[model samples]
Target: MKRGVVLLGAALLLGGMGQAQTGSAGSKVPLATGTGGAVATVDLDASRAAMRILEAGGNAVDAAVAAAATLGVTEPFSCGIGGGGFMVIYLAKENRVVTIDHRETAPASFTPTVFIENGQPIPFDQRVTSGLSAGVPGTVRGWQEALSRYGTLSLRRVLTPAIVTARYGFVVDQNFRNQVQENEARFRAFTSTASLYLPNGQPPAVGRRINNPDLARTYETIARQGAAGFYTGEIAQAIAATVNNPPVAEGTTLNVRRGNMTLADLANYEARLRPPVVSTYRGYTIYGMQPPSSGGLTIAEALNIMEGYDLSAMSEPEAYQKYLEASRLAFADRGAYMADPEYTDVPRNGLLSREFAAERRALIGSQAAPGSVPPGDPFKFQTDPSYPLRPAPAGFEGNDTTHLTVSDRDGNIVAYTFTIESIGGNGMVVPGHGFLLNNELTDFDPVAPHPNVPEAGKRPRSSMSPTIVFREGKPVMALGSPGGSTIITTVLQTLFDVIDRKRTLAEAFTVPRFSQRNAATTGVDLGGENTPLAQGLAGLGYRWAPTPEIGRLTAIQFNPDGTVTAAAEPRRAGGGSALVQSGR
Candidate 1:
């Protein structure tokens, strides 16, 4: 933990060099809007609607909930009310932070064997698809809870933008069309799905104006009736009726598979607020969503391991070597120890302890190995009883959602990330819902006894890292990203860029990104690790990642001068935004 400060100083020293700065590849700053010393950024126009609520005097909670609802329409492929996620909030009035774990839970009827095939385990791909894989959705429930507690806006008011977008029409973009085209085959597999998506038996071309009148109507119902309208109201009944028929209609969808889904599942679902996992490195505090999520622990472990080295003076290659070594070690701990705390007794504290971190740091060598093995730790056997085991066939590799950062002059901030699993999710669309259902259930480990095995109502482990940093009891940064597991790494690196390297928010985000999966024993897979500096690090103990695995990141910095400067990952169309109080 002591290394945090040192790393910062090192970054600052290096940043002061005459190295020329480069623009990010696919990152952009998000559009920001607010007033009275507050600012917010979201991925789409509707998200801005949520920010408008704050501008109109709503609090952080209200703005976040509004932003979430708006995303259901504008960023449907990334997130919607049908999905589940986590929320990290910094409450200015209370001077405290709370993490809402509205993450999806396994249904009671869920069982590990559901994914097995012909008396044997099924492949990860098959498990990632199909109806049996769906968990109880918490996206809407979670946001609603946030609104209830911290927002000042009404649900109807907050949801208005989503309603308007769905009712009329929104122009399709290249990314939108691309997502549809990519999933065309699977989308055609379900009749109802085909009716909604394949109106011409093909994806709409980019720039085409597409409309979902049904989804608009549904949104209106939801706004008027609250979450009840979507879960137990006519919308739920319509979904049930449609699900009873898998065939598609000429102009609508009936492709939902028949199954055990009942109104009870929707009505019974509720998002819970869980304590966040908190740790301090040097003088900075890092907080993340708890288990059923790997972000906090994995990030902490990586940082802990890195703390053991003096990476500042090392050349790029040397620094890269040490970074990769630390990541590898932490990933090993993540694979062996990380899981849903509700399902297993994860060693949350010990893993973050200074003594444990120091011991783990001692194991890294200056030479990098071609391939990696799980780092050994003697503490596992001595501390707690391990959870039941499942033979995880080499864990499969993968993938983002979208992120939003919000803050007010009062010091309240919210760092949030949302997703619909893969690009188009399950490719199942409810008539009039104007969005896709999340395949989030697929995030659960398909193997039995893995602690993350499917159970009705059990939330799967997620890589989403929505974080807020505090300094001397004041909120300093509210940031998060869209990369699956890579989200944590991108976020951590950005934190280093900000706190240590002294880079501006935009400059920090422009730095190239890299990542490793949830599994242990593998080096990071970099999407853009081919830089001269990164290449240099490959010579050190760090083995650079291969091509195409980096994740996108977006962040907003609340500077000491009261100005907010934001930056979005250049790898995507998204851009970051900032705001300042007029007097400042």
Candidate 2:
């Protein structure tokens, strides 16, 4: 380990010696280093907490769990135990990659028309805050499973920093304050929420110290009693009650509908270990979360399509066009076929097959397609003639999520993306838990008899693309981002930047992002809109819309010489990346 650390440091120094200056702001962001490990997350305190775990002799999984726990306290609006996520781990010793599905599942009492009223859907605002939006959270169980299966430390030990931060307090930053203030009306709907977030009748001022002893107690119970503590006992009861009988402010008449989740649903929730969606792109193997998550398959399909084009030789505008076309095709399939495989018969094999990609690739031309593209018949390539080809359904997407990437000296890596589904999720906090519950159930379509319709115990499809890349049978990169449906395109763009354009990890993250997603107007960042890439697409009959933000990517890259580089998206405030040398 010590020797590996030395070689890694030397490689980083050499890699940084004389690189050409890029105009991207991320180029100016200093990279953090550690001899024993490295961590990149959206919160500085969370990164430091994870680094402390590595320094204490924990491995990559342990540090990841630690950072995840801390993020719950620090970035509560984005993620917490009340939510669920996916984790992709690269086990260095075993030379294998593993993925864990901790995605929240609909309650057993749910039905296809749960969100439908009369013959139409309920109002978006009411549904967003109502108990009907909560799912059986899977985050706590996921953390426990990862730790027990691959970690070097106990849950009690790994959760210490988060527990301390929640009990004592952490300073609120401008970003956090702004989020709170923006959602003040929603927070005001619940007494428990307002008490914790809007203390003294307003959102905590920037840099103000905030504490949540109740949340600390909840973590304490989990530490002492394991996953059961959160899923089956007092905490579980609180969660159920909050969802089934939500508290409304006086005279507010929320008219919110109750959810069907019971204690039994919470108790029965189990995180699964699933096989990752694997595909090869330019000699590198990409692994991502499978069904219940459209990220892996969509990314793989996009890359396969672009592989036929010489992206490196093409002008910026040409490359962007190819990317937009690929995204359109993949998202069309996402709406048609992507869903929870346990409940739906998704043509997984056909979707990731190169031949299937070729069939779809033939649809793209020098000109952009008009309006939203329709999904293709990939199932036609399936060997199973008896397989059911269900009709695909369109569903809403969410963007409030967080991601963390970590790599230890031992070579193990973790790429995890978790979320509460929306900002201040459901606007309901478990009475004393000091955390927000996810609206993941809304990810399902309100229509009946569709692939993505709500169903008993079915996991909602997600676009959180927790991913890992390998070269020549060895792990090389762990990457992911948070941006709802945009996640797939964001990751696809960055991968192309690094692999085809030969940009550093920072440059790849800093580049302006763009996405089409089968929509009539392509969404581009401010910079992308002003570039020739936009004008060229417009000349090809494409309409463009400017997006304020696209993704918050956290990525770590491992060089052949043993050195590792990690970075958090520069676009997000409070983002952090740090590395610990092997001999630390």
Which stretches of model 1 miss by more than 4 angstroms?
A: 1-42, 238-259, 375-398, 518-527, 541-549, 573-584
lDDT of 2 at 458: 95
The residue pairs found clashing in candidate 2 are 33-579, 34-579, 34-580, 34-581, 35-580, 35-581, 35-582, 36-580, 36-581, 36-582
Separate clash counts for every candidate = 33, 10
Model 2 regions lying over 4 Å from their true place: 1-30, 385-390, 579-584
Write one digit per residue (lDDT tens) for candidate 2, span 1-584: 13343243233222321121122112223354324477788876677667667766889999999899999999999899999999999999998889999999999998888888989998777788999999999999999999999999988778877877786788888879988988998899888888889899998998789988888888878888999999998999999999998877776656767887899999999999999999999999999999899999999988988898999898777777888899899888888888898988888877878898998899999888887887888887777653655566556777789999998878899999999988888988898777889999889888777788899999999999999999999877888888888888888988988998888888887677888888888888766777765777788778878887788888888877666776786665545444444311
How displaced is residue 98 in candidate 1, in Å?
0.5
Clashes of 2: 10
Candidate 1 local lDDT, 92-189, one digit each (tens): 78777898887766656667776666877656555444555455668777777888787777776666655555555666767667767877877787
TM-scores for all candidates? 0.86, 0.93
Per-model lDDT: 0.63, 0.83
Worst 10 residues of 1 by lDDT: 16-25
